[model samples]
Target: VNILTTLILVWYSPDAKADAPQWTFLLCALGLFAYQSLDAIDGKQARRTNSSTPLGELFDHGCDSISTVFVAISACIAVQLGYNPSWMFFQCFCATTLFYCAHWQTYVSGTLRFGKVDVTEAQFTIIFIHVISGIFGPSIWSTKITSLDVLPLRFATVAMTIVCGSVSLFSIFSVVFTGGVGKNGSTVAGTSVLSPVIPLSFVIIPACIICLKSVQNVYENHPVLYIMAFGLATAKVANRLVVAHMTKNEMEYFDSVLVGPVMLFLNQYFNFYIDEYYVLCLCTLWVIFDLMRYSAIVCMEICDYLSIDLFHIPLVDHPITQLNKNGTTINSSVVNTGSRQTRSRRHHH
Candidate 1:
């Protein structure tokens, strides 16, 4: 599945066939949707049959990360070939990395959720928008009103920009805080001893500066891009906060202190910290954290499936379990017996 997805992306990439027919773009868009759907199916099948393994989970996420990278690369090639702005490609790439990192960290920590508003849900929504707008060229349809055509392209572009931009900002913030405390040198902090002020400043001061610059850049020339960037950053932060709060962990205390003070500081000193170094450092840290998260997720999945114990594995002690009507333990022995009974019942029925 991963190979096929990559092949399709490469074949339909902007660089693959210069001046390709308009229909090819639609084909590429459709291919991406199909790839994502197939990716989802493998996992769905595993869970439905209760055959899910750590290996499968690891492969699924790994494939997803790789597939996203291909999408970004294809976008970059397409943009460079004059299909879209280069910045759009960069934004998509950054957003994809941040989205993966945030979700990967949350998943490892056992704090990730699936619902109406979460990373997974948001991703599907974004992809849907991309597919629709990419195919139809972002024109809205209205029959009741006059011959009104909504330019979906503008909205879709802005939405993509915002989702990616916000995620990148959140990643930068988390990296600074985590790096300041020297916990894994990534956003996945297992511990921290720094004062709330220092850590918050490390994270927020830079984020504020980037966001301000991003806003100014938009206001001066491209307001639409700016809006999209801001929206993306907001969504990423909001998603993180929701997951963090929902986990109900002791770490929430530290995060609460960190988030509040930093936000306050950003509001107070929005203009004092703009510089290239800050943006470079934040982006660099984000990349590092994203790579680590991707690798860690893959490793954890492999270890789980093979039942191999690794000293560095996070959340390994909390293996997923099932419960019965009486809420008692359901061990492997019980699982086997239950399977046998289920099979017999199916035959009888």
Candidate 2:
């Protein structure tokens, strides 16, 4: 399946080999569609045949991740070696990082969920944007202003790049701080205690700047790209708010309603080209990290159900723990139970 997926991706990849004819792009697209179709089939096969072992699950995920990376890289290379701007490759890299950060944030929070019945707003938007851009290309909406002709497509590309860069930076910081706490408690590098203020301050300041910039761009140019960029930035900020609130309060359906539109908007506007191979590779690494983390959680849950004790698990030695210990009988079972309860409570919402 992995080999098949790779071959399909390569064939569908827009990046043309110097030795190959121009018709290869068409062949590549067809192969990509076939590969995607097979992606669905493999999952069904695993379920129907009762072959859903941990290794099988891992392999499936690995293949999916690799295929995505291959597509991204191919797009980048196609642009680099073909008709697209060279700088577009950098944009692709940033976009891939943005995707990874979003994925990481969800996985680390233990709220990672996947489905086929429902299309995620991000996925839907991206697919829509790809189709529209492919059909319309550079002539989507052309307007002229005082000695200058502006293309909406170019604006869209630029806006997407800016949004991708901003979001990627935000995601990197948020994931580092939050995931650090999850893995090592309040302190990072065994020192420098992390406070709510640290992350909140870091995230909010830059977010405010970006939002203001986006708003300014919208007012000055009123380009469709700026609007889309603003939406992406707003959605990311809103997501952070939702996550923080979820940590403290109940999850609400209304929150989804509020945030869903921005995600949908971003997905529809974000574009990928053959010039972002490096960026796509980086995203693949990010996805691997996320999948590994998710797999770790799954393994731990399985161990708990099977009554198997994994050796030497790292425990977060928070200040609260020190305060709770008062030279009383150190009941190991009580400690374990307390830890498990706390973890469960943290993840429940």
- Candidate 1 regions off by >4 Å? 1-17, 74-86, 107-109, 114-159, 163-349
Off by over 4 Å in 2: 1-23, 76-86, 111-155, 161-349
Model 1 TM-score on a 0 to 1 scale: 0.41
Local distance difference test scores for all models: 0.41, 0.37
- Put down candidate 2 lDDT per residue, 308-348, tens digits, no spaces: 44433333323222122444432222222312423211111
Model 2 scores a C-alpha lDDT of 0.37
Error of 2 at 89 (Å): 2.8
Cα RMSD for candidates in order: 13.4, 19.3
Q: How does candidate 2 fare on TM-score?
A: 0.37
